[model samples]
Target chain A: MTAEFWNGTMAAAAAAKQARVQVNAAYPITPQTHTVEYLSRFVNDGELDARLCKVESEHSALSACAGAAAVGARAFTASCSQGLALMSEVMYFTSGMRFPVVMAVANRTLSVPVNIWADHQDTLVNRDAGWIQIYTQTVQEIYDLILLAFRIAEHEDVCLPALVAYDGFILSHASEPVHPLDQAAVDAFLPPPGSADRPLLDPARPLQFGEVLFPDWYPDFELKKHRALADSLGTIRKAFEEFEAASGRRYAPVDAFATDGAEMVIVGLGSMMKTARHTAEKLREDGVRVGTAALRVFRPFPAEDLLEAVGGCRTVLVLDRDIGYGTGGMVYPDVTRILYHEDHRPDVLNFIVGTGGKDITPATIERCVELARGGYRGRVEFWPDARGAEEGVPYTEEPAAP
Target chain B: MPNTHPESASASAGRKLHEIRLAGRGGQGVVTAGDLLGKAAVREGFWAQSIPTFGPERRGALSSATLRMGPEEILLKCSTAAPGVLLVLDPTIWTQFNVTAGLVEEAVLVFNTTEAPEEVEARLRGGALPYRLGVERCRICTVDATGIALAVLGRAITNTAMMGAFCGATGLLGLEPVEAVLAERFGKRASPNIEAARAARDAIRWRA
Candidate 1:
């Protein structure tokens, strides 16, 4: 089918619809509301035959999804920020129980200051929750990855929950072109419903999920979960390859661009990668050796691929939209640890940027490159050094129109 | 605030990117207008993205939307630093905000005003405007979009009319795509909006 204009939320909802999600349990939240709202519309119009549960809270939403998945039914849900935080308990429980539920997270900043803008802190906080996490850079990736999420999460080898996170408002509300897959294509890519050949809560076949575990076996269960997540990288790679074959759109754990013999590289995740890449291209046009790489898969933390993307460069400036407080940016340590053991490693600098929906424009990326090249030695420096002191606030007080 | 105008490398990058900023109050369909603009661009086979900068939800609060469209993929997800076009659905918005901030050279500034372009500029220069236009060079286009909207749609929602004036001013997009998208979106009630757009397009007054 020809491409239609779709926001990131619409793309995600369309993917869920195409995957034939058995049950959709979600609470309305900003940025994320449109995804579930679209799903509800699909249900109302009879376009998608699924149960759209109008849940009271994000906790109940994920609980309902867990319940549906426990019964051998495909389940889907979505939320962000406070909503994702509320679903934290079930986020762990769903993965621990191996429900293979799929979720969409419109990545937003956490509260306290009470902001409703894009950031990766929400997803990064739950990074170790035993769930597969994939970040998207575009509206198309939202559709492709959410579709691939189902295939990867439900794979026999990786029966864990998965979440696809995109920048809130950036991806959630922005409209772009998305070539949605046909029903036949989606059907061919994913296994048919109720074909989850795993332990199910079948009345005929008695089984127990999330049962109480004694200390004696709990550590082993934890180890198994860890091993399953690490091993899921293979499953993820395989899915990416198969998806490329089916849909002419190729994806990798780390999507790299112009890294060949580059001296400086900018690395980022989610929607900011495109801007970084664009700035890199512009820098290259002026004969500056620069490149960019997008970290697509976060949970598996594809260390090798990430290394390959920025290993050869003299400097790797990581633009992280979320901070880990005392530790620096969430992705900063991850990158440095990967490069620490290497004989030829680049100096990785982390710039805490675009937090609370600040604009991570091409100009911001350029400033980052300048800082990295200037030998500014800070492990994690807020790009402007002082917030609100870089350029004038990019907003105008649009008073009520008379 | 840092002078962080949305950076405009479009000209030097050798890309034909059209960045647009829309200014209006809440409930004026500013975001919807951006959507239609982007959709129309997509219809003509150009990549387009439109985003609304949503603040606290309240009717009549100041609201804004941004759009970027080009032959190639529009990668910059940040707000438009230097818009090539600025559409002000409310003439009074000039008195409150610098609606013309960070406009590109030879940019198109369209306004919905009953007064002539000279009057609008006089008011802007007479210290009534809260901020300077701060633009280097631009072509100003004036249209009574509110009047057209009221005459055609019986409302003061000037988004469609402003969009039409945009097309008329820049000629970047054909009226066909805009009309087609309006037809597809509004169904039977599309005619009034479409008529408003056409009338605004026909009635645009230009000042270089």
Candidate 2:
């Protein structure tokens, strides 16, 4: 196999080129800029046959991509931070329209003070936007998951737009060795788009798409959207299974590391999962009975798989990178919702760590596990400190003696 | 860290090349070093790739870049945990990160500072480090690079100086290939930076 090294941004663009994207609409934003720049280069170099659309804003970018996908062309776009928040309205519309467009989201902190660092707040702000969300922990996973996203989104049953998120700077900027799938292998796995005979939107078919409705028909439309979203879980699983068979890389909605027979388990998504994994290994060495489960796919919340992953554990620490303001962490509420009806569930605790690109080091992760072991049963526990002071706080001691 | 070589005869028969990791604050040309190294390697007819890591903000944050070169296509796509060459542009990295955690025994460590190798080695007391190179008067190189950029390319960029230091230190790819790569990278502004790179190359001294 021909090997080439790529940063996270280049890798995503390369995969999109290989996928033979038909349309690309993007708004220029930091951290996310390289992905678009490389795609533009691919188009300029004639490596990709695609229409590159430069939009006025992030909202316009998604709108253009959705419009292109509605015409049954494989469309792509990306944005982060405030850009994602700006496109929140169209995000819902794109999914409800079943456009199957794929986008990369460099997970960045949403801000009133304008911070540009890694956090889940931007994407977490619109968790109900009717899109499939997958968080990646490594650059390799970022490349692999983007490829899987197209398959999952375009599945006949799913037919929803997908957003694959990697932590801004942490994963997006972190240089890592990624085994890019060979073009021949990728072509064999994902064949060229079948005949566009199945028109999602055709003037000849004369069908109404995304028509506004009053309270009278809105309930039925809402029900239909809900059903379609619920139907996506099976489609996601099947797609992942097929991808694993082809690529030899397995994925799950919730991936557990060293969770078997553990007394306490930490749940996280994106790059923090890498930290948690390392912490778990260290904790296990210390005989703390700690483990980690990363939620790979978060949209159609993998309740069954997540519950099963943490089934026998006594304490469950759900570490969220984004908070829900006065309420608590985002995933805490979701996990609570799942456990509310269950007969047996772990003592769920929430810890919000690493907001605004704060380093969530192994020490912090180990401390969270120690808290869980000490029987801290509070509904929410902001990690290290509640007010995000753990951010900007220097390490207690230098890593290397000065 | 031990290098793992496949037992198969076919894999063992080929010549092994080098991989380098450069770490520093953002805007320090850490990424540029990797790019120049890759370009220079390509000029020498070897496969090369450069990968950069940084946050959204432009400056005052941890940034790193990696360069991998080999005769055969390199398959591993992970960070250089056990880097064969570690180049630190900012001394703050020694305190900020576990930078030396997985350096291989025969690795080379290069830093841009006035501190003697013995002083830096003493600072790394408990830790067994690789070989060291101190590019004293590195700021002069940076200044020269800026001056050359203005005189030739009409912009102040330090990428050339860092590239020069890399070429001077490693000599993995000879000066001719590096100059060609520099010409390709900075086409209009090649002359002054070429001179600056050569001067910086001369400035680098390996610790005895």
Candidate 3:
């Protein structure tokens, strides 16, 4: 297969095309609009044999996808921050129903003043929801991960929906190289939806989805779902290994770079990981041993491996895009608890970087290292960013071009 | 200390990574210019990446796009604070913000004005805001890009014209790649933009 230049959104749509997604029921939003538009163009041009439901809202978009998937169709949908929030009600429901609906989430910052930019806040809001969440850094990762998403989500042992997220404009808009997968290879790697494994809403064998249950039965169901989620971690690893064999792109639950024999490890997720990884290499020349760990699978929450990646290091600096509001960065607590058992745990530093479309430069990374060397004072640091003084969405007299 | 440029350390001839920052308002096709330039770079057998400053994407609002191209893989990813080359689609964008805020000491500045480079620099010097950009070290090139865009595209979208000036100033990409990329980007509507690009590329000249 030939390598092509594509932004994250374009790569995702292209991957979805090769994966033979039968239904793309979506509401277009900034950062995510290109994806559905691509699918629409593909369908209109007769290149792709698929159905594109032009739904009005993200809520309806997901609902329509859920409906299509219930009837045993390969379904997909995508959205950004507020759109994710709007569709979150259905997000939980789709997972609870155990529909293998693969969704691509372009991570965006939440809105009090309507900032449509990159952040993990949107993707992590419903982390506890039964869906398997996978985050990607580059355009290639977005393409490969979405292809692997369907296989992981449809595993008989783990028939849960999946959400694949990448930074909104950083990756979604930023163009990079991605190797296109041949449809034959993808088709062979991923079976035909595996709809027969579970009871489908067929005309002959009709079953109700999202059924009401008694409190006593509901607890058992929730417990079973938790067990399935824990079990899906194994399936996720297997899927990644299989994907590697099939596609030659090795994906791990956590992408570790130069972690072995490192003194400091910078941990992050999504596009920021690329920054930390590259910056770590540069800092290594100055005799500062810095490693990087990017969490690829957030929902399965690769705790054991994450600890292993940071265990040899003397200090751990976390760059989280999601702010936990009064609690500090959201990833801090999730990661800090991993180091709790040690007699003398390495100093864990938390800094909020690249929030609300702010650029994460090498200087901010260097500053993080400096702060880490000084030892964390139990405070969350927000990097200096371009937060436009005047709030509200910038409005202009001229309209946006198509 | 201000480490925000999209480029890493300047490329060692064989490993050269050229960086360009396009500055203008939202409506001026600034983002598209960066994207097309990157595409052209890729066509010329180099790795290229482009990222636009995305936000409340309203027309006439301040907008910038960063394009980085190199013989090898370009890893440095950040908004270009200082680029090797700077192209501003609007002559008066300096009035709103210092278009040369983090310009490299010896960077090349290409403007979309009909006036000569000296007149443009004088106007910049004589503006209400104090000039903080590099003085006497940088080279200033002038192109009547708005005029060319109006003549060719029937509008003042000077992005392609400025891109042509970038090629002429840097020589990183030639006339062929620029025209090819424009055709691919605009499809049937490319003729005018290509025409505008050729005129800018030919007429781009710096002050003595």
Candidate 4:
């Protein structure tokens, strides 16, 4: 792998270009415009000879991808926030057809506030929509995962659409060191898309596609889709291991840092995991038994992996970017189900922080660990980070700038 | 603070961690300054990242960018609270932004004003005592960066000018890499920016 400094937007675009995507059904949205724009540049410059479908709306963008994917062509697209919401219908249909369409989503907030910033609400709202949800923290993961998504999505075991996502501006705009593999290496790793998988549309071998399913037959299709979603976990791990062997960098279902013999564990999705991990390191200096567990693979939820990672901690802090309104943090509900039945479980504190583009700071993570240590249970009430500072009067000794 | 990195006294020491937040009016090239600083850091074999704060900034509206650089990799994506260096491209930025907000110990605040150091401190420090500034071992430096940029580049963009001030105050790294990065990014048009940066470096003075 070639190492270089790349922001998320450039990494995503570069991956698509290197993968030599056959079709790009394009649409432009805040934070995500660069992905398609960059691909279009490559195509125009003769670096990538792909069909560029400059679609009208995000709806058309995904629809065009679905149409292309059905014809056994490697298709890719990207969207964010409102565009994602508009294309929600097609996102489900794309996966239902088992097209293995790959998408990169710069997770942003839904409107009412109408802000263009980083938030988890956008991806969280669609967690149940049959797309493999993978959240990345660094620029390296963003580039690597875009290539991996196609492999996992088109695998014979899991023929489904996948969304390789990251926090919108936080990662999409932030620059970091990335290991960009040679095009020949990437090409060897990922076969020309659809060369391995079967497709519905064929001119020589005529076949009907997406016909109305009878009530009895529909359940079978749904069950198969559900099974693929659950069973894809193994394929994801296998691909990660193979990737690690090729590149010196390793990946896993859940990345745990400083978790061994820890009393407190903080868990989250997207870029905040890095901040949480950094806080754990600082707290480690202070002799605090703190650790971090990041949900690298969100769709499969990595429940077993999370269980093993957090089993040693006495108190687990779940910092959520998307709140469940009346139920508290969105991610907490699923995590609760896993630990509730266990005989020995860490007391989990759910913090609904950093919603709608606010930053989750190391100070905030420290506060949560402190609260969890003090036997704080259920949803948290303190606003000790930059995001909270934006909503009201400063509450922490050091309110970080957002 | 054990975590704090000492300013470079040698080539090996040059990779010290530095977090700089630059604030200025919309047209002042604050974001461009962050980009240039990052490029220079990379050229010097350090990891540099900048996040430009985009908003409804028209001509003179507040535009700020946070820049982070270190010897090793930086993992955190959040904005810097306790910056090692706080750069104010415009003196008026002090009124709107808490320019001194989260300053680590021995932090440097480099101003691009033509005023004397003591006078700028008096105007910037409010009526509060020196300790009330909330920073211990804070070094305040001033330079006529705008004057240098205007004269050399024929524009009021003080990014390169203040960059020179940063290098002079911190003595962070050699100006060779900075000039080289400028040459690459700006091509043949880099001469004026390089001159502005060098002039700003020469014009800087520290407050007692």
Candidate 5:
């Protein structure tokens, strides 16, 4: 196989082209603009036989995808932070309508200070948006998961939309060597758009969709959608297994590293897990039994697999890039609730870190491990209390002109 | 603190991880230099990653890119803080930025300047440069990359020339892979950049 250097955006666009997405509608946003730009280039070069929809706003982007998917077309879109916030309403509509529209979200922080940096706030805020959410740790995973997302979202058992998230700038802008899957392999692994046995809004059939249900009927439909999302875990695992067999790259919902009989395991998401895992290896050299468990799939929650990864450890240090105001962190509560009734539960500590695009250095992670090992517990704390202090790049103001 | 790199540190031998920071203005192709180096390293069967500093890059404003290359997969996704090599595309960058911040001891410095090592050191000594210990010990490689670019490409883009200097001074990457990467990226326009790189590589002056 020929390996090429591709950043996360190029990988996502390549996967979409390979998946044969017929309609792509997206609005331009920082970081995420590159994905759609690459797709447009593919379309212009006649490499991808797809129609690029030039939408004006993020809401219209998803609306256009929903329209295309309602009629048995494989539709795709990409967005981030504020753009995702704009598409929040359509996100719910697209999921509830069961259109199976797959979106690639370059996870970035929200505004107020108006920053464009990597964080999980954008995707984490959409945790309850009724879509299957997955996170990626590397550029290769970005490509693999995008292809897998199309298959899982289009699976007959799970006709729900999905979001493939990678850290905004960390993975999005960073270039790495990725051995791309062959087009024929991807074609064999993923079926065409209309191949699934689902109802399509054909002009000959004239079926109605997105009709408002009465109060009593609304609850049943909502419950069914929720169950379909929860039950889609089976479909996700099956797709992962098949993709692994076809490509020889193994993936799990909770990708664990060095978690065998460890005293402390750091739980994190996105690109920071790479640094955390490296730190764990270095700590192992220093006789510290620290491991890392990254949550690849966040929406279905993957509680059982997460527990299995960290159940044997003495302490679980949860790193959350997005804070939940008074509650501290978004992932910490879910982790605590999952281990609440387990027989072998580890002490969990939450650290609100990397908020507003702060760098999560190895030193920052090492500090967290030390705290957990030193019996610091039962409280959510902020890391690197002094900004940019963990990394010793001293700030020096330019001297006044002589 | 965890060891950033827990391997040996020899330029020509062993499985060592090299971290390089390319500092330049936005219009000077700093990010593209890192990109070419990374792609070349990957082509030579080494694990490589390069990322531009995240922000809105305005022309004439300060911009930088970081590159990491090793014999195995690189797990750290963050930018390199303690780089073993620093490439300065604009000599004026030394005034506005530290330029040598977090550099490892006895590191390598590649400059896009026409001055010799003595002249460059005299200038820095005259200025108020903080943390002079590491800067004093670093081995310096001087090449007029901008002059080479101007002479070869008729433009002020120094990325290709800087890439050549990096390959020449470090011997970490061969010229064949770098030429292949340039030909693939620039297509028919690759001839001038390749010429500029070859000139800069041969013209580099090194001092311990």
Candidate 6:
């Protein structure tokens, strides 16, 4: 198999083609426009048999995808920061109805100042939408996970929508060598769209998808949705296992790197995992017991896997790209929720870095680990130095000493 | 650095394509240099990849680009440490950052400066460094590119002139193939840029 280096934009389009999408709907935005442009080319060249729906807004894009998927057609769409927010209302419907639509969210900073760099605040803001979210760290993973997302979302036990996200401009524009599967192999791997047993608009069996429920049935419906989401955990793992067996590239909900007998651990999502791994290697060489874990699957939370991975560690640092306003960070609260139930939880620390594509280097990771090990117990600590503001001076401030 | 021997016909057949690094202040055509090299490599029937590293503050800050080429495919995506060729568009970058910290022992260093090669070599003593051309040639090429861009595309983009210098220095790909690529890349304005690129190719002088 000949290896070809593809820019992330091209790789994404190639993956979409491999998924054999029946429809593609998107709105143009910076850093993400390139991917859609490639999709347009693919559609025009007949490489992909799909309807390229040029919508006026991201809301209509996802809505069109939902409508298509509800009618038993495989559907795909993509969006970023403001676009994601614009589609927030329909985003919940897609997941609640269990449409099995896959979306590639180019992660970007949500705005007031109108920034277009990479960040997780956009996707993280949609956490309660009931969508299964998977964050990718590299261009290769971006290609691989799109295929996996379709399978995972369509699984009978996990009939839920899925979002595969990667940092905009960071991974989306970065070029790297990726091994693209042949068309035959991809066709063999993804079977043709199986009969959607639960179609929204079946003439023979009419059912209400998003009906206004009375007070009595509304709580039960919501509980059922929660139960369905919880049941998806098993299906998610099985899909990952099958993908690994076929492709020979293994992926897990939570990936731990160099965490053997480590006293301290750092947890992050998206591209920061790469920085963390590099930092972990450097720290291990210097004889510091530090390890890094990246949560590939954010929704369905993977509570058990996360607890098992961080168990017995003296300290655990939770770094989140999104902040929950006055309450530290988003992942920090979730990690604490899981730790609260455990009999023995490691000293959980939360640090916010890489917000709005602030440069997070290996040295910043090292500094984060040092702070966590030094008994810093504040709710949230920000790595201002990681922005490369002050040079040549190290550890200038004490970080409020708590 | 000196050319020990003329490049063999098949020298680059299996020897992985050389990795080149270009460093300069923002808006100095550093990224353009990498893009031109990539386009030319692709035209020569080789795979190429280019990436830019820029800071938040867009202008006047240090920006760099890396270009990799090879027969099979290029995979090393990070910044090149030991680049085989280093093109410095701004001399100030040498002091502002450690741009020349790592270079292959036999690597050639090209700079846009009026300083004597001896002075440049003295500053880069730990490793062998050679100054091949000055900013005068680059400014001339830039002026030509602006004229071509304005006349052809109604916008002055300096990337074409950098493409010309790359073609002149390396002889990696003929001007005809580059022009074809430029035509495919920039449809309506290919003719003027092709002429500008030819002028740039003719203007460059590689000093030993």
What C-alpha lDDT do the candidate models reach, one value each? 0.85, 0.72, 0.81, 0.80, 0.85, 0.72
Q: What is the TM-score (0 to 1) of candidate 4? A: 0.93
Give the runs in model 6 whose Cα sits over 4 Å from its true position.
A384-402, B1-21, B24-50, B54-63, B66-86, B89-109, B112-208
Clashing pairs in 2: A173-B53, A177-B77, A177-B78, A178-B77
Model 4 clashing residue pairs (backbone) = A2-A180, B82-B102
Q: What's the CA error at residue B35 for candidate 5, in Å?
A: 0.7
Ranking by DockQ: 4, 5, 1, 3, 6, 2
After the best TM-score superposition of candidate 1, give how far the Cα of residue A353 lies from its true spot, in angstroms: 0.6
**Chain A of model 3 scored by TM-score:** 0.93
Each candidate: chain B TM-score: 0.90, 0.72, 0.88, 0.87, 0.90, 0.68
Q: Grade the docking of candidate 1.
A: acceptable
**What does candidate 3's lDDT look like per residue over B1-208, in tens digits?**
1111123232342376666788899999998888888888777777888888776778888888888888777666667656777888987776667677666776778888778889877776775565545555677878889889888999989999887777776666777888998898889999988888888887776776
Which scores greater on DockQ, model 1 or model 2? 1
Worst 10 residues of 2 chain A by lDDT: A393-402
Query: Candidate 4: lDDT of A12?
Result: 97
Worst lDDT run of 10 residues, candidate 1 chain A, spans A393-402
Write the residue-wise lDDT of candidate 5 on A1-402 in tens digits: 447899999999999999999999999998888999999999999999888999899999999999999988999999999999999999999888888999999999999798999889999888999999999999999999999999999998999999999988888989999988888999899997667778888989898888879998988998998899988888899999999998999989998999988999889789889899999999999999999999999888888889888988988988998878667779888899998899887888887777776776677787777767877644455444334532343322321111
Listed per model in order, the count of residue pairs whose N, CA or C atoms clash below 3 Å is 8, 4, 0, 2, 0, 2
Off by over 4 Å in 1: A383-385, A388-402, B1-15, B125-127
lDDT of 5 at A238: 93
Cα lDDT for residue B84, candidate 6? 64
Please provide TM-scores computed only on chain A for all of the candidate models, following their numbering.
Answer: 0.95, 0.94, 0.93, 0.94, 0.94, 0.94
State the lDDT of candidate 3 residue by residue for A175-240, as single tens digits.
876777788899889887534387678889878888899997999999998888878989999998
